[model samples]
Target chain A: MTNRWIVLMVLLPLLTGVLSTPIVARLRLSRVLGVVGLSATLIAGLLLLNNATSEQAGGILVSQMGGWAAPYGISLVFDTFSGLMLCAAAAVTLCGYVAALGTLDRTVERRYFHPLMHFMLAGVNLSFLTGDLFNLFVAFEIMLMASYGLLCLAGGEAQLRQAYKYVLLNLLASALFVIAAGLVYGMFGTLNLADLMRIVRETSEQGEALPTGFTAVSVVLLTVFGLKAAIFPLWFWLPDAYPTMPVPLLAVFGGVLTKVGVYVIARTFPPIFAAGEAAEVIVPILLTAAALTMVLGAIMAVAYRRLRAVLCMFVIVGVGFALAGVAVGGETGLAGAAFYMTQSMIVAALSFLVCGQIENRVGSDDIDDAGQFSWYRAAPWLAVVGFVLAMTLVGLPPLSGFYGKLWVVQAAFTGPDETPGHSVWWLGLAGLVAGTITLLAALRWWTGVFWLGREDQTEEPPATQPASTGPRSLTLAVALLLAASLWMGVAAEPVLALAKDAGTNLADPQRYITAVLQPETTEPSYASTHGTTTPANDQAHRASPSTPEHHAQDSTPPATHADDRFGPNHPIRLRGGH
Target chain B: MTAVLAICVAVTFAVSVYLLLGRELKAVAMGVFLISHAANLSILAMSGSPILPTPDPELGITKRPPISDYDFDGALRHGDIAAPLDVMVDPLPQALILTAIVIGFAVMGFVLTLLVATSRKVQTLDVDELATGEKRHDPVERPAADGTVQGGAA
Candidate 1:
């Protein structure tokens, strides 16, 4: 039953993508299909979450396409972390889809917008669930291709320019990803992530060192993923590109894209890259990056005149939180980061929706222009909801964002004692300062846009104009997100528990390794009938001769190299062979 | 062989930088293309030279000879043929570069279309001119009351 739902989650969106062309003539039907498809995904996610905590030993549930085994066939794995991410992604996409249904122009809607949106959601789901590296690449491509269509759905000059830059940057990242995957495959002769993890662990243990070529490849991969996550120096393009989209589209993009990159980095770093002495070196570097990203993002937010642009800056703050957690490099840090990310996604979506409402009411997103209008008088609900979300962004106590940050701070303080001299502590201090600065920045914007009256008096429009009515659908969407944010903050314990489970699962590789390595002896009906084995089974059979101990030994020299490059106590190990 | 690839990459990089810094839109587009090619070449170089001997047929193991074994004549011959066959040149990078190139072309085309459309509608390609007239107005504002009689005084 679980497998059936998993398959449905992937297939529904793909089916929508395929049927979109023929259905393009019928915009209403397409919209209905999109909503139904996403609704199904949301249902599947809920079911998966229930299954996750049902004492069923919720390791990754591997589903082979044609019963073909690893090193050859493709497979999808639904682990707890991925399941939770998918649930969030599905919920967010569903809301965005519904919100967009009322706002999209009929002409644009008929041009396959709904289907493309569903397909993109599908790609995101697949990317999260897949256990193979190459499959992850394919999922990204699918998502990117769909994004291209959505970005240009309105086809204006600004949209074209922004989308072009967005596509170009992502293309580079994707290229780098493929190059990295290729190098890994050429070296390891397999693309199954689980298989690669085992091989990497074993190879590092054996004194047979990974070639410098592969290490270079790893750096390239990290760079690409880093760009996607919009960490520090790589974040310049995002603020410009994201705000150019229509509100609902921006909401979904804000909720999902960067987080997917963060997910990949978080999932792979511990087991594959930071496995050895390098863990000591790599953690600090990540910590510094996180601190810089948070600080810079807040500073930029204070400078932005547009509400959407400011929210885009906050997306960088979310990235900082995720990186901070990874930099902290322990269970507490990971759980905090995961919980923070979940909270950010909800808050970001709500913020974007509120921005859309403001834009709708005031006829602009510019702080100066929006200030002329009385939003509180024009749309009281929007003003109230926006204020709540703004507080969430600033990490107010009793909000999910605050708890998330608290956890991260706690994790940082309690980090490994061996690396006492590491600068993670300094980075943590910077983050705390940055967090306070961000709160001030948010408050400043709120005051400017809502509280303070415009100095330059302009004739106010008649109150009877009704402030654009702000599509009932969009209001509903914003309310949904606002409620979720409140719920996440108030009912935080269960979600934190889930995040803790996910963090523990990530730290302990034994269950994941075993599930992927050992096939059921019963020779399941699907395997025999399809005339192929599961990818995991093939991986287990074609195991490398080297053991984990050998790889651990081989990782020593590079670990020293990394330690030398980044001080001995640096949290992050740059060149350590993991 | 790696040296030759490296030089090619360096030249591409230089040309890209030169074009990118130029004022014209076309030059920037061309620069993007050049930089993409340079990146692709760099990836190829990082894969190492194909001139190195192929693996022993039985064991599928390639052997690296002493530096003295590589003289100019051997280098030229290896650089010529081995560049293509002896080494794989990292097929992954090649595939990635190809995708990047295609995406670059698509973006360039879209930008060109935007430029053309904007120029036709606004009568100028200058950024200052474009920014000054950013507001969306009705199409009816295009002509005067007499249709052809505009404010132009020749």
Candidate 2:
């Protein structure tokens, strides 16, 4: 089937939430709608993953919005990377939903929690799929808006306190994202990723020098994404904001939300700018950032007492691993990054779930206090599942994370031969050592939570313990995630191959352009598919260049670069070209 | 015109950053608002001036709208291989800023809500006195060495 159907993945959640918000508000039917929407998103996500991974499709799916060729209207491209994220997002959201049934208080439920969660999904799905910078900004806002709402859903003093910082930091980041998008659009006269790739390649091939602000723009974009990903210098906001969230929401926040930023950087950086004129400087800067982020996550993981705080630190570790792959820039590194990012999304969310579970059974998230209650005393099977996920986080063998780290290490060993600046050995070692620290931390978390007998359980009873009442859904959700992760581990080869396919495709831009801007895709009458065109030469189209923002009349306008008159190479000289 | 806008953008950005660094939450929120607008102005300035074509000697207008180069009607369909004329201003930036404006408004509303809720809860809008995390409760022993230890507030 044509990739047109992938739009459903975004629309289903968005439309459901948009349409049902009022109904849910009036009737309080959030549970029913949330379940239905989440289940459908999961089913669609799995289907997209299956479709993308299928060999015949080669794991690349592209859909141009409004039947307009790409580089003009927004486009949605779901390669193996995004497809994998979709599945992970769906699983995490589903788990969060199930767990929410037990964890959320009446206040949280009465608020627009369900609609907002779906809105968050919509934003996330769009960010993963959108091929336009403006669309990405919009998606970020949607997601951030939803997150701010959800963070304050319970309306506690502390939650609002932390939520303020979180919202402020993200709002700043959003403003910067716009500035970056504006700079890029103003510089290149195009916002589509594939088109940007094409323009960057064309200009560089002609030996054209980069414009003055080019590197600044690139760094700014990276900075914006870095702030989101919690990489090194910019990660201070994460631990502060994430811990105040209720557990189910925290699961989604740590698991899939932050990865969206990393995904954008990974998708854009290597392909569009890595080989561009300023790349000589860009590569080293990114490598240093990745390395420092890795070390910081590991060191801080050992320093934090709160379970959520430590896991948030590991979220940083996951960012480092994924970026380490991007920094290395080889096929193996990129593939490994993709694999590691996908696995971490699942493991991160599930790990948070397990931690919350342990907190419930025991008294607190602190390690010293957790020793009193063993899985032997609380729940033995949960202990087994937690151990497995923890080992996965530590990159233990036979789990999906191990293979991902292996690829990153192997790639780092050789480095990118094409570029001398990307040796990245110590950087990769940071990732490895970070994994070791993570193992030690996991041991601490496990030992502190499950190794000791009942005599040690003398800490004050946790606030939520009285209310938990042994809800089976939290257990079932963690187990389901564990089982999904186990399947991922067992099926590592296929997943790795899928990641490799995505990495190769990302490293190559021509295929992306063809997929996006091709005149005749699937059928020749695609223009008419828009049904609003009054012949391509309708004089009305001319008037809109003078005012195209409201130029919504043309349903299937030509790609933005079709003129190329305003592009850097052939800039439209105001007084006519000399 | 472009130069004037660039200056405006620079000034706005400076003022926004100044506001953002203030101790008052409301000032910081206003700073974020100004900075977002500054970006919009930067985008506008960078798209460059709307260079009108020299008026035809006999046509007697600043620029003729129905002129050949300005005509896009025949451009798309006939594959009119004509090079683009820089007669009209770029409208894309306007569109982008319009989108940004709406999204920004939504986020700004959210930020205000959070700020309001925070002040209501903490009983103050002062950044330092707001006191976040258990760290403020007991900063001395909060970073407790090794992996697992607890203290009041942190």
Candidate 3:
């Protein structure tokens, strides 16, 4: 039952989008369908999370799509790690959708906005669930396709301009993705991570040296992910491209999109490419980039006057903290990074949501002019919400943000309890400095707007505008998210435990590989039972070339030996080459 | 043969980059289109010398080599789905590139429409001329008697 539901979790949004677009137009039920579709996704994801996270379920669940084995076809897996991401994504989508109902105008609503959003959620869910590399690429495309529409839908000349640039950058990234996938396929003869692991293991057993191209492949993949994750040097596009989006849309992109890139890095680094010769060099480079990113974000944040710009800078700082854990590359690093990501995803979205509300109540998004809103007289609760959110983001204790930072800061200082790497201290230093800067900037902005008196208080012209209170859905959504963040802060133990389990799972990729690649059976499992030895290598007698057990990989595909990167080996006698 | 394919990819991508640097939105759109096709071509080149001018060149055509068969053996390359080793050209990259092409076209269409709409609404297509957000800039243009901004572009 869970197996079938796993596929449905990824498919439901897409199906809803495809089926309901015309219906939404005819019935004008876009809002209703959007809310219903996303709520269902959230519930389904929670159920899946329960199954994946339970002690009896062994922390991993996988479903093979189309009855084909993973090395042969796509597989969707749910582990504590992916399960955590799914839950966060579901929450963000629902909240973002509700917030969107308040923000999007009636005209914009007519333009397939809800359907596009649903499609984007489907893509986000698929990206998390997919076990195949090509499928991951497909997932990225699905998300980007929807995002391209959403980003440009409210097209001012300025927004359309930035949207074009963003599209161009992503197009290049997509090209690079294809080239990387093609190369990986040519060399390894498989895009399935688990299958590749089996091939690598068996090949290494014969005492063969790992190919250097594998390292290059990893670097290419990282570069693509870096563009999305907004690491230093490649991050310039994000701050510009994302800040211009509509506030409701910004809340989601600001919070969740970059995290998706980080999530992919978290997934691919350990399970798929961790053992590669490149892992050693790559991890250090990642740490250096993370450190540089935090410094840059902290400095640039103060330079920006706009509310969203400063918030976007904080988003980068959060990314740096998460990547720090990736650099650490052990149990402590993984656990701390996961916690930091979940916290940032919620708090960042919350900040944007509150900021949008304030900006609407006030006149502008600029921190200076935005301070003109008399919070004491008008919208007192919003001011308080903003103050609390600011405090939470600054890492004040008893807030959700503080816990993640503590774990990450601790990891930075201690490294591992057993062995500390040279990079750990630097990571710690950057984390500490960034945390302080973030707190200072966020508090400064909050106080300037809320605590400080409104501009021209003597005039006392009440809000002449029709109240910013558009719908109960808006208030409901904001209150629900704020309460959820508070709940996470107050009751941190269970979630922390779950994050730690996910971290431990990441530390051991073999467990994930076995759970994904193994076939269904009454017994415990093949990968789990024979996980210690290269069981597939020993059980050659039972498996055929196309066996569901193994993709009977005896030889490296002959294509990679082509003298040039693009050329395939052994040109067909008379007709070889598509 | 590798030389020919490599040169073509490099030239296509290089030209696209040059076009992308232009101030005009149309050029930007063209740059995206050319670059995407370049990417599609490079993918085909990597897939073992399939010289089809377009995706599925063999589809609906009679006089062509037989399509390759998949074995799905773990030993096979590219997603563990094995194409017959004896096949002249691998069809998988073609399939992948075809998908990329269709996706690219859809995205390109959307971008072009956005470009036109923004130009029509803002009365300019110059990238530098349009810096989003009304409050960010303070251009002192006088309004017409009808309360339109002189030109009635919006």
Candidate 4:
């Protein structure tokens, strides 16, 4: 199949979401429609992944919009990394919706809840697909706007108060993002990622030094993404703003919102700017922040007596692991980061859904309310689910979380060199300490909520027993997510392979650049599918006089120079000449 | 000209940051708006001095400036391009700033509505009071008969 159709993954949700408001209030079939929309997006994502990893596509797919080729027009890039993230995010949101069907309050559901959810999903998918920096900013605004509405929907005064902080902080980040994009455009003269990569590559090849403000621009970009990802010092807005949302919304927020930040970081860094002093400055700072985020997140989780608070803190901890893995910046490290990121999204959302189930049963998420009660006697299935979730969060063996964390630590200790370095060992050490503390916290949580009164209450129903078993749909949703997590653990080869492909593609961006800039040359199949190019135009493009540098650098050819599209061949002037 | 723009952006940012740190919700909301404006201004400054096209007397038509010919140093090299860089102001930054402004406006509208609703429900616009959750506890604040605390204290 041609890859241009991958844009439908975004269009489907956007159309469905915009239409959901009328369908819900009038026909009352929004639930079914929401399920169908999300499932379709998931299938499209899976298909995109298959096409991206297939031999014909060469691990990357680029679709230019409005026939305005690269550097001048917007492009939608669907690489292995985007495909994997797209699939994970779609699956998590689908499950969250199903869970919400059983758990959402009727008033909220009537107040355009499903529409907002779908709108948020559309923004997320677009963020993953967009190849331009400005487009990413627009996507972020879409997502954040939907999130603001969702956070305050059906909220009392407290939730609205929290929403104020959430909106303002994100507004600040959005403003910073605009400034950063402008700076990048001023320096590089292009907002397209692949074009930026080409420029950065050519300048370094010509032995030209980057500008002095390069590091500052990099820091601003990092700060924008860091605030979104909730990295160390920028994470203060998360813990308070998140818990005020309804459970299903919180589940989606915990799942993909922060992951989007990590996604951009992994996509931008290493691939575009990993060659020089910028890497030297940014990598160490990233590692330090990762280590600090890990230790502090785990500590906060341990200190919180509430289940949702603990879950929220674990989301931060997962961010730390994923960031560390990305900062390591090699095939192994990036692959590990991608793997851990996908796993954490699923695991975190599932844990939140389970917490929602607990809350529905007991009317509160406070651990003290459980009060030395053993859920084993009251609700065996819930006890089992909660136990598995806690174990996964603590990164125990044979679970999905353990595999990803193991790879990250392995990448850290091995470092990029032949021998391990003393510098990055502290990151691994921090992960270990945090893991141990998480285990302690998980034990405390599990015993207090699920295993404490086992001996004394044997076969005796307690006075404060849980209400009637919650809806079957909620159980089904939890079970589906659990099965997905377990499947990832037991059969991790396919996912790991996809992640490795993504890492390989990221480590060497030439294929991506060519696929984007000159699709016909890189992937001939693309030309056959979309017959917009002519042989006469191709000749003129190659023989254009504006690219004298390509002819000058003939002695030592770069790898991408096999095709004349590589190097400092001006794309716009060439196209204009034709 | 660029230096003046730089100073203007700096001052705008300073004012926004100060307002952002204030205790009033309305001030914070305005701070967000000013910050967005400053960001837009910085982006507009990236275009440098704008040059309006003039009709050429000989050709009887205005010449369109060529697109950028910039290297990594952000310096223009006019060797390859047909027209000199001075005649063309890069339009991409203006496009970006436009998009940012529209999104900022939508966000500001939402922020205003949220602030109004929050202050009405909580009965105070003070950010510190909102954060304390004290408003939720005492939704109505009537001063004591002894007049120790003023009504609607800032």
Q: Residues A188-303, candidate 4, lDDT per residue (tens digit)?
A: 65788987776666556655566457778888889999999999989987877777677777889999999999899988887664455587788888899988898999998888
Q: Show where candidate 4 strays beyond 4 Å.
A: A273-275, A417-423, A454-466, A521-578, B48-86, B135-154
- The CA lDDT at A442 in model 3 is 85
TM-score of 4: 0.86
lDDT of 4 at A14: 98
Give the clashing pairs for model 4.
none
Model 4 / residue A526 / CA error / Å: 16
User: Residue A310 deviation, candidate 2, in Å?
Assistant: 0.8
**lDDT by residue for model 1 over B24-50, one digit each (tens)?**
445655676667666656655554222
Best-to-worst order by TM-score is 4, 2, 3, 1
What C-alpha lDDT values do all the predictions have?
Answer: 0.68, 0.74, 0.72, 0.77
Candidate 1 lDDT over residue span A1-578, tens digit each:
12535666788778877777688878777777777788888898878777756775464566666766543556677777787788888888888887887776778777678778878988888988887887787788778778877877776545544444566567557656755775565455456777666756655554345444655666677778788789988888788677767888889989888888888887877777555444555555577778899888988888887788888889898889878887776777787778888888778888887887777766667787777776555666655676787789988898878877887777777673335563357666877887888888788778777777554556776565445747888888887888888999999888888888777767666566666655454545454568765443344334533356534644454322221222211111111111
Candidate number of the best TM-score: 4
Local accuracy of candidate 3 as per-residue lDDT tens digits, A472-518: 66677778789878988999887798789888877667677667666
Across A15-78, the per-residue lDDT of candidate 2 in tens digits comes to 8788768876553466777778888988988888888767676567888789765666788988
The clash tally of candidate 3 reads 17
Give the candidates in order of DockQ, highest first. Answer: 2, 4, 3, 1
- Candidate 3: regions farther than 4 A off: A26-28, A198-207, A421-423, A454-456, A466-470, A522-578, B48-85, B131-154
Models sorted by lDDT, best on top:
4, 2, 3, 1
**What lDDT does model 4 reach?**
0.77
